[model samples]
Target chain A: MIRHVILRVMAKMLIPLILLFALYVQFHGDYGPGGGFQAGVIFGAGIILFALIFGLEPAKAAFPPRVLEVLVAVGLMIYGGTGIAAIVKGGNFLGYGALSHDPVHGQHLGILLVELGVGITVASVMSTIFFHFGGRGRKDV
Target chain B: MIDLIHIFLFTFLAIIAIVVIRMRDLFAAVMLMGIFSLLSASLFTVMDAVDVAFTEASVGAGISTILMLATLSLTTSKESTLYQRPRPLALVVVVLTGAALVYATFDMPRYGDAAAPINHHVADYYIARTMDDTGVPNMVTAILASYRGYDTFGETTVIFTACVGVMLLLGGARTFYRWRRREDAGDPEPRP
Candidate 1:
């Protein structure tokens, strides 16, 4: 596939900005219109764009398939673990108020943790799907 | 004012839907569907559902379009030209379903009716106490992550399952290389 010089340079400039925005969304979600799910998809979209612009091999090298497989499960585990943490702290399942001495603090922390988990799972799964579909059928891929 | 926006968005959405159905080329149809999603997302945003709009824009316009394009690249770009008339039974079924849905909608409460059954139900409590309870200003996130955490967890699980299923069915990086080698060895390209 013939690559475009302008597109590659443009993607290089934009990729980090996209990633930073995704993180901003993930963290600022408590007070704003975005959340883990939206942030994760946006993050994955950035990586997918990287894959599209600079061949699958380079993208895969940057985000290894092996690490992706582990990260996929790890994100879900983080979410589940947060729930269990609340349970062990004597609250009901997913009860955020039990994690800290102050109930509101617990809620804030719990929301942040689970949102991070959701973000990780979503971003990794989306990128993995792209890698699988994007890498298929090419000799060099 | 909102109603006017709703009407305008719906008109464009309907036009896009018809164009998608009438189109023969699969790639063009997929692109049209992306536009359809974008319109719907805008409608959601206009209706004060910013969270839903964000998801729709990212998932519908961003991810799904790219995924569809990737799939298209792997297979034939143009749709098969074997045109077939729509089945009468399918059309009847679709019309019946649409009628049933419209009939059901007539019995539904008016938009944002404070006295509606759902409004008086758990929704009122969620709205009233979410701020005190969750500390998060975004009620949607609070409800999704804390109040209705189990449901969100299940949704994430479902998406995770889908990814695993696709990876299994499609094989992996190694298979693609092997298939290429076979093609280089003068073997016929796999039919699928």
Candidate 2:
């Protein structure tokens, strides 16, 4: 269908830009109008676009349910693990100052890890929501 | 000059909201809602809340619209002509609340006043301490990810729970096939 082809082309062009923007938002949070949460949503939007264009079945094929489920769990674990790491280092949970030899470096590392977790969980959950809604058999386009 | 642009944007946003609410076709209403969200995001940007604007633009205008459209595809496009009786008491109450809010705004600080109580109090501390403590220049990010980390965790959990509920309630392909097979067998029970 023309819609499919147009969507595919748009996905090819726009997704990369979105991903790059996510990185820009993630790394440049300290200076600009974006951060972990914004970056995560933008990244999720890119994946959602791909899913929308390719159909839910193909999207599922590309990102298996088990893979998405695991990523969701892993993201949570990573976020929690960072907090636990801080606690183990004689600080309270999510105490980034206790993360490494240098307090500032530790903060950077902690933020990065937590942001990665946020991005993963957000992207997975968004795609999962789309898949769930779009995968209904009797639904007409 | 900027004030004039802001006023124009505000007018545009108001029109979009009116159209969204007034539209009879559900699909058109939903699409108009997307426009409404985008206009809201623009309004946020003009209000100097860039981060909130970005989230609103992406989530409200983009993802939420797509989700609504998908759901719409599964349902009837035509609306029933049933009419509901208007509640004059409720209407009066809503109007009174709106008037009160508009009146209260007259006593508030002008837009972006650095000497405002909001800027001088808690916001000042967060803005000052955020850079030294979190090493991030963006105070919002520091506040969200570090100071308010628990709230973010709670939000993530909420998303996960919603996804789980969606999966459970919306039966998968196998269940759909089973239901279809039963329908083919001429059972009196209606199919989901």
Candidate 3:
């Protein structure tokens, strides 16, 4: 640890805000300039900042590698599953029209879910890459 | 005013690119690359491509900079000056490519030309129907997530594939650390 009190205090204050902003970007994509890809990177960046300030072990403790690896696959599954779901409902692949009673609402729901899936996968993969990269050459694994 | 901003940003971009190319310190080059990305992101914002700007800022300036710094720490911060010989062939190739690109730009439609061929194609339809079809206010999102859902899915899959590839190569972090430790301990024939 750097023993820099100001750095610690600022990081503590900023991490939550970064994460909240990422979620805002994620769900607010329909109304704004952000979406799943941007949100995921922002979210991963928040975690990376945490790791940078607090050290890798503590950050890994907060977000285990096992959980991150699982989330990576789960996000892709959610995306693919959404398409399969449309097929099951007798619509074309990734056709949001049949996901609900109202076609417009179905589209809305499908977009939201799909964006969520993208966000989750991107976030986890980014964090995983950072973890593995940062872990190299350290005596403690 | 926007044109002035564009010129100013481009000037800075050119300066940074030259400086990055000439810089011998890898750390400084990485920082300059981040600045370059930030400038391009601003340019994208100026052009009303907010989504692209957001992505460029995050992925280009943010994540990639950090990764480069991390890699620098793991390796050397000073770029090796062994390849200092100037190659005339390389210069000729680069100049030819640059000239060709500049020449091709002459045929491009003026910036923000509403009647351009590209705007007349599917863009007009998407712009008109996005709200009705997807009920999303952001046309970019509507097109990405609904109108061109297959493309977005492919992009997501690409990201997933990149992650899987990285994980496969670097997943064995413990093994890597162990190998490093053996090398540090002066083992001539360390186990693979």
Worst 10 residues of 2 chain B by lDDT: B167-176
Give the distance in Å from residue A98's predicted Cα in candidate 1 to where it truly belongs.
1.5
**lDDT of model 2 at position B179:** 74
Cα lDDT, model 3, residue B141: 89
Interface RMSD of each: 0.7, 1.5, 0.7
lDDT-superior candidate, 1 or 2: 1
* Candidate 3 per-residue lDDT over residues B44-112, each given as its tens digit: 999999999999999999999999999998999998888668999999999999999999999999999
Candidate 2 Cα outliers beyond 4 Å, as residue runs? A1-5, A139-141, B171-192
DockQ of candidate model 3:
0.84
Query: lDDT tens string, model 1, B103-124?
Result: 9999999987778998787988
Residue A75 accuracy (lDDT) in model 3:
88
Give the Cα error of residue A114 in candidate 1, in Å: 0.5
Lowest summed lDDT window (length 10), candidate 2 chain A: A132-141
lDDT of each: 0.90, 0.78, 0.92
Writing each residue's lDDT as its tens digit, candidate 2 over B20-119 gives 6677788988888888899889889888899899889988998899999988898866666778899999999999999999999999999888988988
State the displacement of the C-alpha of residue B170, model 3, in Å, after optimal TM-score superposition.
1.3
DockQ of 1: 0.84
CAPRI classification of candidate 2: medium
